[model samples]
Target: MAASLAAPAPAKGAWLETWLAAAPAASGELALVQQRGREALRQQPIPSSRNEDWRFTDLALLQTLPLTAASPAPAALPEVASGALRLNWNGSSDPLVDQALPAGLQQLSADEIAQGLGHTLAAAGCEQHWPVELNHAAAEHVLALRVTSRSQVSLELVSAAGAGLQALRLLLLLEEKAELDLSQLIEAQGSGLHSLVIEAHLARGARLSHGLVALGQADAALLAHVAMEQEPESEAQLSSVMSGWGLARLEPRAVQVDGAAHTTLRGLQVVDGQRIADTHSFVEFKGPEGQLDQLHKAVAAGQGRSVFNGAVRVPRAAQRTNAAQLSRNLLLSDRARIDTKPELEIVADDVKCAHGATVSSLQTDELFYLQSRGIDADQAAALLQRAFCEEVLRELPAAARSWCSLERLLEAAV
Candidate 1:
């Protein structure tokens, strides 16, 4: 870890100042992003800790990451996830990496990146926000791409940053009838810091399927922001299966401006030993005729910590919209902890919205049923556990393969 990435001077009530003080001086877009951070010092930094959304995994760990805008030496990519497509960047410049993107997929220009980031960040209502200023200040190299309707594309992006932080800026456009299987895995042999900013746009009558997963050392900071915008009559299914062997932070936000758009979001994670994983998601239905469904699950063992904070907001204009969200946790050890919160806000009357969250131990009846078969207690528990998580993976494009492989993975985890 760079001394700069370590803690900076303790400047009371000045998060941005402290951050900038520790950041390396630079020029151009990256510099502007830094200046934006300097400006954020005025506002009270969103207090994230044991009392806030970060009640589970304390964000004090984030301070350990070097906030510099330094370039990372090119990192290698992983071919498959732990079992399937682990570290699967596949050398992609875009989220859906390909030697030649399909006809409908194209990178967005600087002007387009500017338009998308500004439009989405406007929701936070944080005047002079660091994220917005940083986005405007820095225009990362490479063009963000889009995959339009009815398009069937399977792509991967894998990278290994030997040391320090490397940034990837992706702009994804998914049009109607477009389908995408996007898988990304980031890892490094040494300490590697990674920053990813992705903006996705789904057009009318289009459908999108996306997945993100990562595994790496705990000494580095991984800040990922995903902004998704949807048009009318569009459908999206997004899944995240993250492995937290090290420290990990993921913030994925999705917004729907027009009505008739539906989306299902789910996240699955397994944590053991002394690891920390955090996920924050916000879904906004700004128009009428929208529907959003969210399901989050986690299994924690040993001294590990896992968190899931999800929110669904239906503005007044969102009449006839239906939204349901749930967060579930399976704790495997007494010392381990799982924090979960599911929120729902509906300003429009006559709209159907429900939210619930629960954490509990395995059912004895289910364990008994498995034991009654010719299986031992351990095998019985693994069998029941696999069945519990199957629903989340049921929507996978390659469900059959995932089923078999996941069964084996469960057996190994047990």
Candidate 2:
């Protein structure tokens, strides 16, 4: 392990001060946000084991990433499907340059960007989270757009960073009755920090299907927060797959602003070597008759660690809310560790909410059965891991599923 990445926490402000000092001067339309983020981070120290929410995750891995910017050096990416628009983001340049967007999809004007930015994050109650502040402090540009009412659009975003720090911010609005299919991919080639924050709002009757695939190396780290707000009659489906990071933390938050919306969340993470992966998800029902279904899975091998915490809330005003959350984990090594927590808080007598979690190793009987069919022991174990991950992988959009191969995921897990 790299000593810089494994070093225990540093004195209160030493690490962050160095990183902030090296960041480019705050400028552009987001100058205010950047300034505020810096101020917030300066006042708060890196979260440690004492903080309940970050108790199991370590931020020490962030100390050594180069303060200088890295160039884009993504691996060979998969081809996009026919009729889908693909945009490559280099973290410093505008991705929409020289490309024509399809009808019904347009970039938001400066005024619109100012008004819509951070709206969903506030609605999801994570606007001031530590990771979010970090993104706000560093990100200089945002890709903001709107899908016209009743229009259907397909979009893909790809980013690959070499080394150092890369920050990306995105905002999406689905107007009433509109539909959008969005697939995003983030990959890292060397030691660095990848920071991402996404906020989306679904108006009444709007629909959004999103898939995210993140891959990293043993010395890289990733911090991401995806927040969404849905109006009545709207629907949102989000699926994510992650693997191979020194440390990765993902936060997905959703809010049914006025109830009567449908939200489906699925996540799968694979950790091997000495890497760590953690996911925290929250969903709240603000009005009656809301519906939610969430499932999260993880695979841990070697001395890697996996952690998951899922929370669902149904207030008194959210009567008739229906929600279910489940966490499933696979432990591939005795030294590996897995922690799963699924929580539900319901104050509405008429609401139905349930949550559960399970952690276990590969099924001995299943492995034996596969080996009896002439499959080698290693192949049998790989097959079981693949089968276990397919449930969530299959939920990804077609293009994302094609880009994120099943074999690649299994190879990373075991």
Candidate 3:
């Protein structure tokens, strides 16, 4: 049986208080938000295995991480493409300083930021999540922007963490008929905690395509939340890939405010050694004619563990909704573990909803055929793994695809 999270033991209650007390005082544009987050943390217990959403995840790695803010250290980053805008964030300095933005993109005004900061999170129903709270408590600044109507833009945001807590926050608002392609890269250099929260609002006829690639070391942990709200005629495509984190939890939620929107989600995660990777995703259609297509894949080797829970909701008002979700996993070792659940709740009789999950290893016949064709056993296995991951990796934007590849992901898993 799982113990209560409120238990005063070392791993449950006391550690949170200690960590909060050690954190720096909040005083900035985000001061009130930070205070609220601290209060929420104090009121709630650290999420434990007792929580259904976190049942397969362990929070012990966070106790071993530094609780203070991370200092800005120089990073070695990839060069930017000729026509693309690139921003390097150290989790402290303003990436917009002395930079010029293209015609379609502009920094949000103070009033706009205040009004739109948490709207999508609230719409997606994840504003108070523990990871979001952690990000709110530590994040000092936000990168807020708006894409003007009928404008098209491409951007790349990169962050590399050192030894401490790194918090990243972003808010994006896309106007009617606007389009934006955003590629984000996060790399962990040493032992620490990296927390991130992103909220995006897509107006009517707007489109947003986002790709995220995260690579971490075994001593570090990551928590990330992405929430999106879509108006009718809008579209959202999100693809994420994560590898090599000691512990990682990613939650991506989307809501079609009045339905009639299109949403596509793709995710791939690879874990080796004793690492853990978990992804929980949710999508809801509130009105008629919404569509969703989602696929999640995981590869677990050694004694690693992988978990995925995907939920889709179609309410009574959401007639003519079409949604499908699939979870596929690969187990490479006897001790590796995988937990996958794809759930759909539909109250509308006219809606078509489907969900399924599959777990399997490399096909013996395929491996034999590869070995018979003169490929070594190890190389054959790697070929199969690469093929498995490419399905999702190919969905990334061109710029983001250049930042990570199957070879790099495979190497990181080791």
Weakest ten-residue segment in model 1 by summed lDDT: 83-92
Q: What overall lDDT, based on C-alpha atoms, would model 2 receive against the true structure?
A: 0.90
Candidate 1: residue 92 lDDT (0-100)? 20
Which residue pairs of candidate 2 clash? none
Ranking by lDDT: 3, 2, 1
> Tens digit of lDDT per residue, candidate 3, span 116-200?
9888999999999999988888889999989999999999998887888899999999999999999999888878999999999
| Candidate 2 wrong stretches, greater than 4 Å | 1-10, 411-414
Off by over 4 Å in 1: 1-47, 63-99, 123-143, 148-150, 396-414
Per-candidate TM equals: 0.78, 0.96, 0.96
Task: Score residue 238 of candidate 1 by CA lDDT.
Answer: 75
Better of 2 and 3 by lDDT: 3
Q: How much lDDT does each candidate structure score? A: 0.63, 0.90, 0.91
lDDT of 3: 0.91
lDDT of 2 by residue, 303-328 (tens): 99999999999999999998999999
Can you give the lDDT of residue 240 in candidate 2?
97
